[model samples]
Target chain A: MPGNPAVPVAGNRFCIVGGASLVGSATAGELLDHGAAEVVLFDNFAFGSDAAIAHLKDHPRLRLVRGDVMRMANLLRATEGMAGVLQLAAYMTLSMDRDPWGGLDVNIRGVQNALEACRANKVQKVVFASSNAVYGYGPGVSGDLVEGTPFHSVGAPPAAILYGASKIIGEQLCRDAFRKWGQDYVILRYSTVYGERQHYRAANALYIIETYDAVRRGEAPKVFGDGSETKHFVYVGDLARANRMAFESQATDVAVNTSGPAPITTLELVRLVTELAGGGPEPIFVGNEPGKVRLTSGGAFRIAHEEAFRAIGWTPEVDMKEGLRRLIAWRESNEGRAAA
Target chain B: MPGNPAVPVAGNRFCIVGGASLVGSATAGELLDHGAAEVVLFDNFAFGSDAAIAHLKDHPRLRLVRGDVMRMANLLRATEGMAGVLQLAAYMTLSMDRDPWGGLDVNIRGVQNALEACRANKVQKVVFASSNAVYGYGPGVSGDLVEGTPFHSVGAPPAAILYGASKIIGEQLCRDAFRKWGQDYVILRYSTVYGERQHYRAANALYIIETYDAVRRGEAPKVFGDGSETKHFVYVGDLARANRMAFESQATDVAVNTSGPAPITTLELVRLVTELAGGGPEPIFVGNEPGKVRLTSGGAFRIAHEEAFRAIGWTPEVDMKEGLRRLIAWRESNEGRAAA
Candidate 1:
């Protein structure tokens, strides 16, 4: 084991696995801003798009590598001289419902591949991007969700359960790697992430974009199930800081929740998005759409990030209103329009 | 979709994935005894042993096909014309701890491959061998463990959590196949299985065998903790019956527990094993063995099988005492001795 688990950012090289992503891009920028020698963005563009990282394309200290997490050679080469690695490559519930085969492959095997590569490359520390989905869905998922909360899957969609269980397996893989080899690592169980570069792939986070789009097109935003379902989402920028803090902290072999400042119900979120989208029509209440994979909680719940503050000296700084405002502003911007 | 999901065992063909092991061999025998025209035992023998299936090697109705679940071609060829496929291929906590890469491949990808092969072959029904591990291990795992119980993994070992989460994914994969292709399937969430042909692979079940071996050599059986941790185990013969019923019944798209009549604490189990082995020295109480993987459940719990009876009209017939007696008899027999 190293004398200290912390891997200082200054003058150190960092590799972001699945780097061409909302969180990945933001973390790369954060690392580069902190005086990192080089920030390598490795992604295969499977779900990633060039537009997501277009702003960082010209940075002298930033480099993009076209790579796939399923391919170990790419990861091995990417992390050869890196001091830290942030694994953000995974498939959310929406895509998992469409293609479970690929989702399981990328989510489970992908993490193992990245960890093995980091071990072989002697990467100083790894910051794995886990999800609060580890707590799971349905009736059993209510109340304050701490890091020790059990996974609840009763009444949940198979795809949603698969996605959650896959994340659980990924986190365990990191823990297993640490036990076998003295690998210093921290797992940030990020809640739904929504921000400037947010994609329409995550089941929970997609609701914000959809509500905004409906309001933008002069239609009432739709809220399912009386809009009482709780959703907690972290801004991409806050998560980016969490990733950087994980690398700089002495915490190792630990996992904690990294959620937004607070959770909002569907009705509240729809109302907030409609107001932010230039005072649109009243929100419409609706039942679940058949054939749609939706994640629902039985009761109101909050994913507490107190453990995160203790683990990496970090906490979510962006509130939903501010985060949503930034997201809407980005949607109207040229870069976001081009990406859409 | 079939008008009726039931697939009669009489005069029909069946394939058992991972069929050279304990549950596989026993289920194959049960199917053959029920007048099935042919029974195919497909396995790679990586964990499966020839001794486990030695008794049925000469049976004209039983055909052993050497195959690996990781290979789709092997599964496709083995599952051809099969009315039902029993997917038993998996790596338990011990093996998963040793090699997580191989374990994840066999547990997750292996289940997907079997389901896909069943789809391609137009198989009538599938009986997936899921485990009670889906409920997970930890302090939160107490009381009656029914089908709807959520998974608890807060304080468990990484390998244990990995094994449980893998089973959860496997069960969801079966559910996904059913929804996508109208595949008829029944999931049997078996607790620890022990019986005549018991193997030394399962973490919980190995305790019984280990205790017996120690007692036989005049050594005191070792009990970790106060020996009050609950362990619920189903007899292999009873599980075989459940597998056969799952195929013969009309139940599909449902998962239920198949456990013994009741649960027994660790100390009670050790005492029973010692008595079953013709009385031995008192068990020695000790702390956890260093460098060893141990699955510790927090509170007393019983895995309920009422749902299994409701779903498949099956319940465990042999209690642990009777089951242990049969296992002891087999161990002293010529066949069991040679196999060991």
Candidate 2:
């Protein structure tokens, strides 16, 4: 099994490149719970906060490395002796719009550094975090978005296109690494991760917490456009499992979608969040906020996770309702309160 | 005329980033011929060479500056007192496939550096050389490729996607600059450029020179696949004219395609080149070259340049046969002889 790219989690070492955030912390906890010998949370904490990883800060099996991916030397050190490395650091559309210079540095150079690190360290498997934004945004993105869906960037904003393009570049870098050096990698195109330790960063998933917060404050939850625009999000824990499965399974040089069970309209999502937060005033349908980089899909679209199951034998176990319940419960918890 | 975006060509200074290559030299000649006050050719000569710009090296109005686009300080100094800047620095798919790290650096960050330089110097206009590759490759790319065509990256190689995505990023960076600081820019999505000073770079345009060289050497020209693949090429001089018009016209915050009069099939191109090189044996159809990154379009596609004429009053004047003749003539010239 020299180049057979499969590594089980039990008693193995794992490194999450953009660790200290929602999916990173969740994946770390999941790996640690599954008897991982060591889980290194490597992060610079630029967008990542200590609060996100506070719950698992003292775990004996976990270690945190403060480093920047822009530095190849840092990555060369961080990924050493790890069985698997999950690269999760990137700037979302909003942040990309704010500071593209930093965004491109972290997204493109960051992924390259992590991959180079994996190559140098001879890591067994890599689970790269690609996004469904690779399908791109705007009117051309609709219907069942499979792995073969072409990147549709027409009519999209610059930052959104940049973020999507960056992800595309990152995914290809993984593919390139695999082809060049036999470095096995699985690119999981996660759709809008939302759950516990949810940071208000992503353009799509922020709507959930924003809606919940509005309801909590006795204000009407605002839905941009007709609220019929579809959002397919994968729960962070489910995505965590997908990341683990990608490493453990015999899947290599493949990319697949890791979306939630079903798509949700904005109105449905707002209502669900309102209901989860003990019900509030009626929702308001409003125009898009000025100067906000909102990712708008033209028609109802479902990101098919069938390919993920086909590729890695993993499926989303957390539905949005159940996922929302957990997120709301965590929001009410002391850690969430402290983090807020 | 204060704050007016258009910069008259007669006496205005212009800077061409990555201006030691084919398009850069052609555009420099065009600018100098139009009575430009000064034309600064700033380049690092990484992919560029002195042979490419040897013909115009001693032009009094043209100043050659060795500078890397990754360095903002270099760009700032280069753009000082410039009326306009034409950013021609980029890595195509073949080079991108080989060294993505360098490609991404020069394509994405290089563009940002150029824009920042233009911003710092209060440059009136910028002409960014984007590519029709923004329409992407493979089956998804066919028919009339207008500016509104969605980027189709499915089934394409990693380097091609990365290159296209990088150009998309560069174009968006131009748009972002326009929005952020009212920096006027015209993104010219040039199709495969071919003419005098044709280099070994550019995957598509290589076919013409390769075929011509093979025929001249009394060998059978090699054609990949059935040679029915489409190639839309704009002469370098025409593209240079388009770049000048982009700066001279009042058009701003616009992107348009600058393609040749029409596209030609690979077979037609090979035959034409063979005839131009003094006829040889017919092209030998062959499978894809092993380990070579060939950008294969599934169907016949034409990159429309109507918008270029509408936007900046520019059109491709030289047809393919004429352009290839010029390219072959240059290849037979003393400078080309020295370079070869």
Q: Give interface RMSD, every candidate, in order.
A: 0.6, 1.2
Candidate 1 Cα outliers beyond 4 Å, as residue runs: none
Candidate 2 residue-wise lDDT, A69-187, digit = tens: 99999889989999999999999999999999999999999998998889889898899999998889889999999988887877788899889889988998998998889899999
- Chain A only, candidate 1, TM-score: 0.98
Pairs that collide, model 2:
none
Candidate 2 residue A308 C-alpha distance from true site, Å: 0.5
Residue lDDT tens for model 1, B209-309: 89999999999999999999999999999999999999999999999999999999999999999988999999999999998899988889999999998
**Candidate 2, what DockQ?**
0.77
- iRMS, candidate 2, in Å: value is 1.2
Give a tens-digit lDDT track for model 2, residues B75-186. Answer: 9999999999999999999999999999999999999999999988999999999999888888988898988888887788889998998998899899999999999999
Candidate 1 chain B — worst ten consecutive residues by lDDT sum? B1-10
True contacts kept of each: 0.98, 0.83
lDDT value, residue A181 of candidate 1 = 88
lDDT of 1 by residue, A54-142 (tens): 99999999999998999989899999999999999998898899999999999999999999999999998999999999999999998
Model 1 DockQ reads: 0.94
- Among all candidates shown, the one with the greatest lDDT: 1
